[model samples]
Target: MERPQQPIEHWLDLERDQLFLWVPVMLGLGVSAWLWLPDPQAWTSIMLALVAVALLALAADRGGRASRAVAIGCAGVAIGLGLIWAKAERVASPALTKPSAVQFEARVERIEMLAPRGIVRLRLVPIRMIDRPGRRSAAALPAQLRVNLPIADLPMGLSRGAVVQMGARLVPPPPPSVPGAYDFARVAWFDGIGATGRGFGPIELIAPGDASGGELRARLSMHVRAQVAGGPGAIAAALATGDQGAIPLDDAEAMRRAGLSHLLSVSGLHITAVVGIVMLVVLRLLSLSPWLALHWRLPLIAAGAGALAAIGYTILTGAEVPTVRSCVAALMVLLAVALGRAAMTLRLVATGAIIVLLCWPEALAGPSFQLSFAAVTAIIALHESPRVKAWFAARDEGWMPWLARQLASLLLTGIVVEAALSPIALYHFHKAGLYGSLANIVAIPLTTFLVMPAEALALLFDLVGLGTPFWWVVEQALRLVLAIAHAIAAAPGAVTALPAMPQGSFALIVLGGLWIALWRSAARLIGVVPLAIGAFWAVSTPPPDLLVTADGRHLALRTIDGEIALLRDRAGDYTRMMLAENGGFDGEPGLLSEHRFARCSRDLCIADRVIAGRQWRIVATRSAYLLPATDLIAACRGADIVVSERRLPLRCQPRWLRLDRPMLAQTGGVAITLATRQVVTVRQPDDRHPWRVPARAAQGSDNLCCSMQGLAKQRQL
Candidate 1:
């Protein structure tokens, strides 16, 4: 006989204890509202909206039924919106309008060494800027600037808190590479970085400031590198000091593809391992004395030690978003243990998320925050299942059975977490690991149990100059981990790449996942509907047939042979890669001039593309030079769209849209669908976010050749 499903009300009643799990979700919705809301509203308007929602919630609470819960949910959403809105206002700063070359003196706030690239990056607070005439100007600049100094030019004794004078070229934070791509400018805005540039000329050390914590971190990283050599040493330094800048690019990419990159960062797994080790040591020491064990509360004392260890470890690891979140969760667990309650649960995870959001509301949109919390939540939810709990419970069995059970449990947890994170991974990185579970089964235990402990001992013994043995162990273990990562990454179908997913589809998938993980009753199964629909929608969405960069000098299109064709064979690596990824092609693109679908000259290119069963012609500029009016007009006579890097004369008009330099400047980038004549832009015209650069009025230049030369120089940079 088949069992009948219960009503929504029955399920809700059965899962009443699970309501708190939705708090973080509600708060995240509010954050999303602030981030994705099309219309820009004033701070006053946001405050009023928050007040209205809070009052409405109060009124709803007075009513009967489940109105109170609804009211609370609404209030959470309002708080999220208000929190992010306030954060943006607090961090707002002016961005650079154009590229500038000038002399400047600034205090170094931080330093990061990129060993692979042989660059030393400095985060500086400007003291003043000097013009070409050697006069200090009052022109406003960003509060913080990130400058990259070539290793050869890096001055000796340059460290954090040092003030140095140097000449460099500065430019505004770059916009998105294509429509619907990640916005680096937005991230820069939140980080308070107004400009990014490269250093050149002589670097004169003005004042080498006193030693600071940053210097200690740098010294520790350098010492670790010196003690151990090669990729293993780099991994050890990353694990020990949270400085991943020195990691080799090849090794990092392999780890990323193998899904073991999380080990490179300080997060829940690392923190938990450290805390557990500390607690075990403390407990063992305290139990040595029977009198003290009976008189004192040993577990509570050990938990306090673990809590302090978690905090200290977080600080040592730079206190990044993921580390801080893990620290909060660990503290909550310790508190629960002190109060004699359940140490780990969904409620605790939700609580930790809420705390993190309250502190860094903008983190809601970042991959680190989302991925870390989502992975933990999914794992906790899985373990909370009654069937899973019973299966892992103790039983009278052989050591082989126990080992098999542990292995199965690890595999199951990995698969569930991977499934929950796939949509998010695809949405952000355009790729997700296919064999992450298989790789992590070996990697996690190796890193957590063998490598970290050995590295910690090595660091401890280094104070007495007797750390060689421990360092050797650390090196050998890490070498094995790296070997496994490389092997897994090279395996067939180790990764699956997809095109950018629509925001709406991503939202549905996330919401469905939340519902399934948060609820305990049959109603949770209902989430499968939206999950399936979102996946189908994501895969079936048609990619743009024609795409143009914001600068308008570069363009890519899908040809009749279903291959991606680029305007220039020597286009920037990042630009070409993004264009192919956005167009749903995982491989290289051919030059449009070489393809049968397009003909190109030094200044002009006309590409023929068929999208959605309709043929369309796209005419675009291939260089920064302006073509003769007659030639341009005659060539683009009946073109569907004209994308020119130089401003097109009014006499030359396309049938549909004309995206010139000015238009592209306002739009950021463009993606077009030929069949429906639909167009998508990187940014909306009405977006009044503080980070957005206002469109500049077009000005006439007396010498077009000079302007073109400057553009060429900028492109080279």
Candidate 2:
């Protein structure tokens, strides 16, 4: 005790006390990589081989500490690979490969109202799949399918447990719209949904579902809707039953732009608020009763109550990955409090992440998992640092020191979270909330102190059939929250769009963030180098000049003025959003105007540009197969590039670059570089992974000819 602490002699002499915390993070990263491999069987064999070697190394114990460390690393890798293999096996099932009309009877497990789309999305569990009416088959179908039924088709109100027979066209979930975009098919696969489609004929309801959790959730949602109607009502229903389908699109966009979208989701913040309020109220009531207070350990009792509250809330919200994660963390913290130990530590957060990753390995590839853990880890690392603690201790004492300290903590926490999540937000969504901290300062307090507690009371009253009055109070609080969100989103520069960063750059940023957050010494500052490099690369990457849709039905080109001009106005929302977001353009897609650089007609649209003193003609047409012979000849006469919705004849454009249905299907969307005349498809051969279905080969070799000719011709010029 009398000896002074010795300074760390080497940069590598970092503390090993918290080294175990990194085990889960490393394993998760490895699992994520394994999931993206092109050959799952190969990886599985490799992992097994590594496990055997690790076991042998442990048995021999030749190199002492170094060998032990190597063995531990190998064991971690093997575990990660094994978890990924288990997940793949569990979710494997027969999937719909082509569109087919079939009569199927299914029980409606849940109904989500897509108000904007004027349809209801039903989550149905298959009862029977028939090739025809009254005919049964041994053919396997997906465990579940999300079917969209038009509102008018559902003349009878749809409810949970309602078995219905209907004729519908079903197809597998569509692939990603663009490279590195969100993969809905993969998400569906993990959710046990193999197909999606819309009902064509009338839906005949048979038997109502028995009283189940889903039915209860439906009842609660209907009650919430009946008690309160409009935007606030929709918000209330979401908060109560976790059904967010009814939320207006405009309101949702406003919340996202203002960075208050987390308030809408049932996450750690909402769960903690509900549990903390319930615990505080219960503890206060217990403390007033001297007999109980003297006989029982009050802190332990309160912690137990809070943990139970968190669990109840989790169940009410469907216990999704994010909700389950929050519940796990809350329970761990409450357990610590019950044991009279410090709770807010990196180890606890890591433990919660480990549990979540083990339960849902696929979640490692999602933004929510990454952002949530990054925020928590950064905050804990910052607050628990000696320098930060010393700084707080040195602050001058003044009136209301406790209040001042609390406010400072809140402000710093907001700042830390935003800083930690900014890169991830930019990488995934291509938009950063510039005023996130300012919005949080106003929104978080209101949401925590007034809104959630009022909601809890309203829910209790609703159970007793006296919820209307308290529901009005909750609506009022929600109105204020929405007003704040609107004001913030309306402010200038509230949300800034950034170009999509390269995958390598994003990887660097993530690695750098981990280094800075996980290390305990001053040498951790070295992480800033990779962070800077990633930032520079992200900003310097050039945008594509031309964009072609997967179906070859739409084309968008970056004009000389830097605006993205669509060859046609109509396109799917996903395709439009991907182009706009990646191109760093905001708002709606711009149509190619006849008065500008392009000429358009009923069936054809063409544009021209001068690149390096050579006139390059771009042509887009509807239904190449339907084009008249004369019109086709005229269109292909002098075109440098042609894009069409149907396959073109080889003789039609022998010397020109052509993109048509078959080529687009094989390559997905294509992006062109004007300077080098380089073409990049959204799906390259190297990007083929085992998670995606294999693509069929295109019919023609015209695309190959174009590539070779274009390069050779460009060099001659």
Candidate 3:
């Protein structure tokens, strides 16, 4: 007698299979929300509430559709709350508010040479902080500090695991440069770096550290550098040791523009190559022995070897989040093989994501995690779609059918990955690599077939002291890869700029992507609604009318004709580049040289215009400079807004709005629309969050009269 599988049982099985895929997504969303909470204590209340709901769901009756839904909802909440707790534990630390000169001994964990900038960045573990002269205690300080050392001052033979004592002025990492911009402080917090600063003087080597694993990795990087030379050598070192700082900035930028930057990083592709090569070699060798081949499960044995090799590769590459993610994915495949189950399923991807988030929830906010997972998810979804499979099967078979199939697969995979990642790339970097798919068509095969294999063989040969020839081969492949990147990047309009999407719209886009990728039925088409809405919103967003830097050191105003006019010439390149890229400016009429409407001298610049039939005058000055009272009074009388680096002591009409250092420090930056008289300020919500380091206490009150008189007298110039 045979029993038939009931429809309800089949449906339940399908639901169970799909349910695991959404767990990580929900957890990531909750973690993002948790990061935005104004107070850390608020997570406690949230956790309690979520736990109650989860318990209620858990207590629901089983074997019903509603029960299954409740169970899935409960699982998602539990995962989210668990991640919130994990993140809180990782970021918890004492605040470092004030800046002070402190002497400390530290072990160099990592060192990066910024050749273009002539600086060396060191990641250090603090041994001791001297609170006062001639007195030191091992009292708790920040776990780590990222210090910059000028090339001229860098000590000789500086290497990882070497202990050094040095004096430096340390300050808490600052908040974001602009609203909705990357939060360096939050990132530093999770990375265990409490402060950042420049070393003041010479660094003295206190003692040599035992050659640890990190030291060995550094030695390997140095050896790779020695084997190769110049920029290619640096690229080889990056491939060998995951120290990307070796690559030149310009080349890195080119690679990014060409969408080939992933080649430099040890990610999924590299992991898979390593594992696949090892597994194939090991399996072939095992099969050669008849006794073992007959007794053992060859596939399982090969998978085990692959998993081990993947783990080794991950460790050798510093076990970064991406490496960990790739390793997890590889291991999941191995596990499925060992269990005689489907190996390449979305469930495996979801399982990998859950593991990564559980171990390092902070990665949820990073672009690498998002983009990598998105690419994988989309590829799996598209490749497994019945319609896509049927369509491909229906295509005609021509000459060289196998080669045609392989090439078609590669091209389709590239297209799917690019489509999946474009929104995220535009949202994060504000640039779209238009030729990314074409570049990948050439790059993916070249790297997978030639570059990575050569590097792996070289490393293995180096262990036996016979790697020179292989290293030479690696250098040649690297040169070709770099050439490809440069050629692609040199293409006209290789990268296009897009305006930043609103947070709400970005959320919608993310939801749409998930819906399309995760859903199994025709209902997935509903995702197009949100995707279209997000795209429309992004295209419709207008550029800001006025731009100001956080330090109040530069200002730009939009002319009536929609051209940007710089208020000052010496603004920082970082702020200028970010603004220019986000505003979709192109070549011709450069950001710096175009629209010279504002006139400037050593101390002052002024511009005037009529907006919406209202006359608006703008005045800007440095704090150290002086202006004659007659000029100042007259300017204030006519100006609708006055902005200065420091507060000025001129009585202005009530209609005049003053923006100075104190105000700018709080707002970070501002954009004003002259038509509606609406002011939009860049103030990050996290600036006021409880986890942020408190600002230093205010100094004494200002003497406006004395400052004004001094300015008047200095006007004699």
Candidate 2 lDDT, tens digit per residue, 495-529? Answer: 87765667778877887877788888776788899
Ranking by lDDT: 1, 2, 3
> Per-residue lDDT of 75-126 in model 3, one digit per residue for the tens?
5655675676676565776545657678888999877777667788988898
Indicate the residue-level lDDT of 273 in model 3: 84
Superposition error at 299 for model 2 (Å): 1.8
Off by over 4 Å in 2: 1-13, 41-70, 130-140, 155-157, 393-396, 399-405, 462-469, 572-574, 610-616, 623-625, 630-637, 654-657, 676-678, 686-690, 694-717
Residue 329 in model 3: lDDT: 90
Pitting candidate 2 against candidate 3, the one with the higher TM-score is: 2
| Tens digits of per-residue lDDT for model 1, 125-233 | 9898866675655456678999999988988898878999998888888777787677788888889998889989699999997756777888888899998898999
Quantify how close model 2 is to the true structure by its C-alpha RMSD in Å: 4.6
- Cα RMSD to the true fold for all candidates: 5.5, 4.6, 6.3
Model 3: lDDT of residue 455: 76
Span of ten consecutive residues with least summed lDDT in model 3: 696-705
